[model samples]
Target: MAIGDAQVDAADLETVAQQLGRTPRGTRAIASRCPSGHPNVVQTNPRLPDGTPFPTMFYLTCPKLNSLVSTLEGSGLMKEQTERLAEDPELAAAYQRAHESYLAERDAIESLGTQVTAGGMPSRVKCLHVHVAHALAKGPGVNPFGDEALALLREQALWPAGDCSAS
Candidate 1:
């Protein structure tokens, strides 16, 4: 489907969740956050203080929470296919291809790494959530991932806190 045509459905999420052994609550939560409200992706700015404005912002409507809903929602494909792969080689191979897409996206965003603050922002980009937030709040120059960006970053170690100029 075209990116615009893509959507996150509660039932689809449930099916995907069931395949991965996640609780219904988890699936629903994921659905709630990404709820197809926004259209475009977000990004961060080049100059953010205290990481305020997240150094990024997206034009799309905001998701429901501070968490990385996009990543969770995107993972649906992998979760849905994992079980099928275990039982069917063809399905598994297909799932692998889908998973490769997900991983490539995840890796590409992770590579952006919260913009590094040009010598580290006064606040620092600790935690993937914060980084993503910063990226989204600031928009563009600072962080490329935006809200979706932080969701990916959250899986890694937090950004160290300190002054960039001093270091």
Candidate 2:
């Protein structure tokens, strides 16, 4: 699997489309991969072909990871992280940095004309999926809350990294 940069091939796009139940719009490249060499994360364009403002730069396309994140959200994990953000200074700072990094990446792709990055970054943790995608795309130490959330999933044996690709 390519570690950081992966050209979004037709097979990869097809795989992501199947996983998501629809063709992804504005997909620029695969940002990360699963252990079995399938794409797990993708970097999207700020603007779609239809000129829609798609601010979400990095997106997770792996069905297994998406399911795990959905389960975490169903379990009130997002709320817990939001509360923790208000309480932990270091974590809040790191999350803010993640927000900045996300903006920089998106800006590098196209001027999106908005400061609001995905996953309720810098202020709240509304979407764990986006944060997890960011962490997977940018790697660890970039998104602290994402790393923590992924750690929680791993701790609970909920992470489906390698097994999904086998299927």
Candidate 3:
């Protein structure tokens, strides 16, 4: 069955490879696209082609977006999010739902046994990149923290508005 509109082709793989500086592992399809029609959020397999165990299901491959998320990470935004996870009960429940949602998507592709959700979901927020990727891949309302981070990115004008997957 086709996964939405993102059927990964050779060119898409090459573009992601160029952006990552290496061949991405377990990438199955483009879950979300950049505004410029480039692969941004990718759906990855729980296990890679070479038998590597990858827990990250939705992988963000766009270099521009990745760089922007890295900038947010450097600014201690993740810590703030993590603190909010404890300070707000509703937000924490929503984050847990996001964690379950992420796990369900990954299990649909391939079961990974462990429930090691990415970005410190249902608890802490270690990586804004992972949360943001989750939000982008799954769309809005699935991951509240990810959505909040994306909103901040948009507000700060840090979201990549151009293609970052050009080879």
Best by TM-score: 2
| Local accuracy of candidate 2 as per-residue lDDT tens digits, 37-150 | 788888888888889998888888888888888888899988988999889899899989999989988888778788989989889988888989999888899998779878
- lDDT tens digits by residue: candidate 1, 1-167: 11122344555444434433452221111211222332112232222333333222222223323323445436552333334445666544543443343334334433334433321222222233333443443433443223334444445422111221122
lDDT of 3 by residue, 5-27 (tens): 34678787777788788986767
Candidate 2 lDDT for residue 140: 91
Q: What TM-score would you give candidate 2 relative to the actual structure?
A: 0.91
| Predicted structure 3, TM vs. truth | 0.90
The list of candidate 1 runs beyond 4 A from truth reads 1-82, 112-167
Q: Model 3, residue 133: what's the lDDT?
A: 88
Off by over 4 Å in 2: 1-6, 165-167
> lDDT at 139 for candidate 2?
86
| Candidate 1 TM-score versus the reference | 0.22
User: Please, what is the TM-score per model?
Assistant: 0.22, 0.91, 0.90
Superposed by TM-score, candidate 3 places the C-alpha of residue 66 at a distance from the truth, in angstroms, of 0.8
